[model samples]
Target: MARSAKAVPWFLFAAGGTVIAFILPVMIFITGIAPAIGLFGDALSYETMHAFVGNWLIKLILLGIIVLAAWHAAHRLRVCAHDFGIRADGAVSIVVYGLAAIASAATVVALLMI
Candidate 1:
């Protein structure tokens, strides 16, 4: 019997997440529109920034982004190692996932702390 391979959403979720995360931030900075589009406008203060990000909506957004980003990093690292001709799939996956786990944990913790 032959084994069949199926596409995984996690792979896309991770790759897409990483690309989107970096691109979104850069685009925001370049366009200088995030500030105006964000919760604060005209005069953005530390308090305003904190308050805005502290909202549930912001929390949800951050969580969504970070969760996906972490997953994306894990998958990308695997692909990178594979591309580099690394044959240790188990070790590679473990290391990649470890990074993702740590990053995801930190992101969630940081959000809750704030």
Candidate 2:
């Protein structure tokens, strides 16, 4: 059997979808809802969050979430474009995946800067 280069993007797409479905909501709750409800009592405050993100492991997790989410979004958009009668799969894939790559690189730089 011949090797298929499509596996990498597909893997990223699946992993990203999983992360979005599973982790994104909890993140929204922790960063948005929980604080509003005062559940953690300043646990999610700026200082606390800054300190939390300062950890290398936390940074890695954050990076994964961001990169995966970006890739997932890009792949979704590409498919949506095709579904919408856009026959230019090559161009669409290039634009969408390029944006994902840029987003991933930016995320890495941003996380590293932290």
Candidate 3:
């Protein structure tokens, strides 16, 4: 049996969607709602947040989140473009996935730098 390359992107899309679903709301609450409504707490303070992000595991998790999110977004955009009567699947796939790859690489570099 032959394996289709689509399985890779589909897997990424599914995983990314799952992660985003769980994390996006929490992020919005912390970064947006909490700060705006004065619910921001000491746990999210500069030093605390810095230390949290300073952990290697935290960096890896963040990198995974960012990369998966980008890949998921790319897949969604590709599907949306197809639905919009754009028949350029090859080009769209290349551009979208390429952007995701670039984003992933940049994330790795940034995380390492930090």
lDDT by residue for model 2 (1-114), tens? 899787888899999999999999999998999999999797789998988998999999999999999999999998899899999989999999999999999999988887
Give the poorly placed runs of model 1, Cα more than 4 Å off: 1-15, 18-23, 26-42
Candidate 1 global lDDT: 0.72
The most accurate candidate by lDDT is: 2
Off by over 4 Å in 3: 1-3
Clashing pairs in 3: none
1-114 in candidate 1: lDDT tens per residue?
Answer: 664331463655656676676766874673376565674454466676678779988898877766676677677778789899999978987887778778888888988888
Best by TM-score: 2
Clashes of each: 1, 0, 0
The TM-score of candidate 1 is 0.70
TM-score of candidate 2 to 2 decimals = 0.91
Model 2 off-target regions past 4 Å?
A: 1-4
Give each model a TM-score: 0.70, 0.91, 0.87
Query: Which wins on TM-score, candidate 2 or candidate 3?
Result: 2
lDDT of each: 0.72, 0.93, 0.90
Q: Assess candidate 3 and give its lDDT.
A: 0.90
lDDT of 1 at 43: 49
| Residue 4 lDDT in candidate 2 | 75
